[model samples]
Target: MFDIYLPIAGMQFNALILVAIGFSVGVLGGFFGVGGAWVVTPALNAFGFPMAYAIGTDLAHIFGKSIVATAKHRKMGNVDMKLGLISIVGSVIGVEIGARNVMYLTKLGIAGPVVRYIYMFMLFGLGIYMLYDYMTKDKRAAAQAAKVAAAARAGLAPPAKKSWNLPPMIHFPASGITISLWTVSGVFLFTGYLSGLLGVGGGFIRMPALIYLIGCPTAIAVGTDLFSVLFSGAYGCFTYGIKARVEIIAAILMLVGAAIGAQVGVTAVKYIRGYGIRLLFAIMVILAGISVSLKQFQLNTASQWMVMCAALGMCAVIMIKLYQGFKKEQAEKAGYAVKEVKP
Candidate 1:
């Protein structure tokens, strides 16, 4: 009933499915500070859209959604403007390189399987590492504390934290870090390359890099990454459009749902803690990897259903957390008011 003809891609697709996919990713994107292209591209492809068209349409929608997500993050003081600006310089150049590579691969008639395999590898590798990091954080913290205490007892200075500390260090007071300019640029460039290659905003990779590599706090990482994503998404959309890969009607339908969903996702960030967000992100990506794997194995129907179900399930979890947190906050406010009146 909701089917619509897309002239750009020359296909009939369900409008409701596009909107639903957008809403799911919108919530995930706003909370996770990702463009959610990882989700959108795969979901679209599974449902019969061509790989190139899926990527272009995904990037186009991401550009609009990031605006809403970034604005909300900025208001919450999570954005680091300085870091975000630096990221754009490297990212833009890197994206151009990656986009050209995709075009070459598309011409070879091997874009589909090749892209899916790479996507699966990235999702699984990153997700596993994050889970391991979360599991070992406390042990690592204790070990570092012990080393400091040992040094102090021996009348020696505390052990120095190791870093590159190359010349021309840059300081970001918002994230409370001072690091080499080279390191920041290198990280963004690599992420941008992946963004162009994989039809992502680079937020999934960059968010983790900001926290682990650059030493930004997780929340700051989320906000700052979104700021960077805004630029990359814009560039990606334009480049893909020029390549004649974008489906304009599909992009618009997705954007409508994303706009509303972004608001809810951003608000949920207030209720969830930094570690909580990381854990959820890890799980989401791992599930995404599995979905892509199913596609690689020729189980197209199963892959389509798996991704849609996972997106809906994750969205439900986030909304429930938000509701619970809101109720608790209200109760505390009411209790405080009662105590003040009694006095």
Candidate 2:
């Protein structure tokens, strides 16, 4: 029973449905270090919200949800405040430049198709690369695991350290990394430009960049990306509010659910490994690419259905993984408790 008056969307909807959608996306955002607006906007549109209102309301809720998730990550020592702040500065400039490019292309009367093509290329390229990384890493991890096991059996020491050792290095204490300043700037600048060009929160792009480019641990990348998402989402909320596109009542309802989901998602990250996150994220983004391609072909119904399925399907998979990990941890704790009881 959708029954809430949303002034901006100019409609009534089941508040619980909004909450459910928010919760699903919130889990993804918290776990994957993205704003998950790509999931949210289309889901809302499926529920009959005006496209503009859907985007605005989703961003508004994302601002609040990011706050919740970021605070939790900070406590977990996952967030690197220095890196996050620098990212904000670089991204803002990048976003502006990206926006300018869009405007220029629009003037050329080929903006829509061009943007769609870029979007398709970016998603497909990133997804394919991540998939490749995951496959290659499996072989590497297996070899390393075998070597370590053999060493322990033979009473030999562990492997030697190899340094990245890039010059003009900058240290992020929270992420426990020292990488080149140019690398950091270039990463954020490119991600920010993509955000501006695609009119997105850029969490998905930034999260991968943090992992593969800057070489942050997966957990830290999730935390740090959420930190960036917080500011970006807040800015989106404010901008949409001024434009009268945000539906406050609906957004508030969604925020309630998002808060809870963010907690679960963040906790799930503790249980999952870096590889697991990458594999799932790669799959998710590939689905998103399919959605965009469908849209480009003017298959409107197919596009919406594809995105909704991707959003919901991915959310379900995340929740199941979280639950499985949580149960395993609980069983381990129980075993420890029994052992400590000593007959």
Candidate 3:
């Protein structure tokens, strides 16, 4: 009853697993403002899905998830439509080129090892950097708060605003900052290519790039990233679909769960601090890196059990992130109520 392709016992898959994985990835994606395709693609591959089918199905699911998350983030006043639109154009071109590149790599018989190694190195490096940044930010915030307290006690004015003199800066009405368009375009181009090459929606990289490089606030970055993903993912889905790489049934099932999870994730963001978000993201990415590394090892050794274990480990990491985010949200709410009553 739950099977999608039962005619071929060796290759048939259960629908329940697809939905569950989708739901889990969706929650993480929404909360972290990422495509979650990294987790989805590998998970599908591990489950006896062909590489092409997995990429296509993952993109389709990402398109749906991105639409839902974008709407939610827009409602929260987090998206920058103009920036997102510009990024989309670049992303589409990049995806096309990336798809072609992947095909070329496959022909050369170097796709698997190259992709796996790149994923491991990039994921691990980014994860470590994020964790370190989160820790340092927390410490800095504490120190700043103490300084502000000391100044308050002394009845002195706060520090003067720092100034920079630069011309040709364009104003972003949404961000309330004047920045160079060159910087923005460069980021978009890089993110676009990465999205295309990795078969991801690019939210993971785009969101952070917006926040750090473009200097957009976290909420704005989340919204804008989702908006960009909406376009990129749709294009990705269509491109891969035309190649007969997508699995419509699998995509639909995953989307069903992801859409709902996205709403929950968007809501959760309001209750968590930015550092908290970074910390969770770091942990999840690190776990994902570990899982991928394990799978690579398993493939080298021809260990079926190890491969399965690695897949399960990835799922567990995602679940852990959800639980932690939920717990943090609840704690924040309780703390807020307590403070309100005391005051």
Candidate 4:
């Protein structure tokens, strides 16, 4: 009953599947500040969509979903406008380059496997690194504290973290980071290229880059990455449309679900703290990588189920957290009000 014709992709796809995928990804995108393409592309491929078409359709939906997520993030004061704007320049350029490379791979008839393998590698590598970062955060903090104490005992100031002092350093007041312009450009360019090649919103890559590389707080990184995603998604949509790779019908269906899910996801971020977000993201990424790997092994059905299950499970966790946090906040407000009335 939910199946619909997709002229662009020349297939009859289930509308319910599209919407469900969009909804789950929307929640993830909003909370994680990612484009949700990593999950969407793999999910679509598992369901028999051509790799190129999956990437294109995923980008189209991401453009719409990002608008909702970004607006919400801005209201919460999570966006770093200056840094986001700077990222757009380098990202757009890198995206074009990556897109061109995909077209070349398509001509060689190896785009599907090539893209999937790259996705697997990147997902595993990034997820493991982030997990390590989260695991050792306390140890790192203690070491820094010890250094400060030793310095104090020696009657000296605490030592500074070493950094590049390249010319034309730019300061982002929102993130409170000052670094070389060259550094920012390099980071975004690399992230953008991956986005183009992988058919992702590049938020997954850029979000962490913003945190570890650019030194933005986790929430700020999430918000700022979404801001950059808006532009990249738009460009990806247009370019892919021109190449006749986008499935418009599927994209619209997905957008309908994403719109609603984005609201819930963005709200959840308000309740979840930085470390909490990071840890959850790490787990999700690793699971997603495993799903993609399954697809590479020709277990398409298994891959589809795994990714869908992961998305649904994560959504449940996020919603429960949101509910609990909302209740706690309400209780606190009630207590404060009662005290004020007594006075």
lDDT of 2: 0.90
Greater TM-score among 3 and 4 belongs to 4
RMSD (CA, Å), candidate 3 to true, equals 5.1
Tens-digit per-residue lDDT, 1-343, candidate 3: 7887732123678899888778877777677788777677767776778777888888899999988988888888887887777677766676677778888999999987877787788679878988888768858778888888888899987654453425556677877667766667767777777666665577777777787777787778777887877776787799888887888878888999888778767776776666666676677777767767877886523333343344345445545655787887789999999999995
- Best of the candidates, TM-score: 2
Worst 10 residues of 4 by lDDT: 195-204
Clashing pairs in 4: none
Clashes of each: 0, 3, 0, 0
Candidates' TM-scores?
0.89, 0.92, 0.77, 0.90
| lDDT of every predicted structure (CA atoms) | 0.88, 0.90, 0.74, 0.90
Could you tell which candidate, 1 or 3, scores higher by lDDT?
Answer: 1
Worst 10 residues of 1 by lDDT: 193-202
Off by over 4 Å in 2: 141-167
Q: Candidate 4 lDDT, tens digit per residue, 208-309?
A: 899988899998999999998898789889989999999999999999999888988999999999988998898899999999899899987888788878
Ranking by lDDT: 4, 2, 1, 3
Report lDDT (Cα) of residue 103, candidate 4: 100
Ranked by TM-score, top first: 2, 4, 1, 3
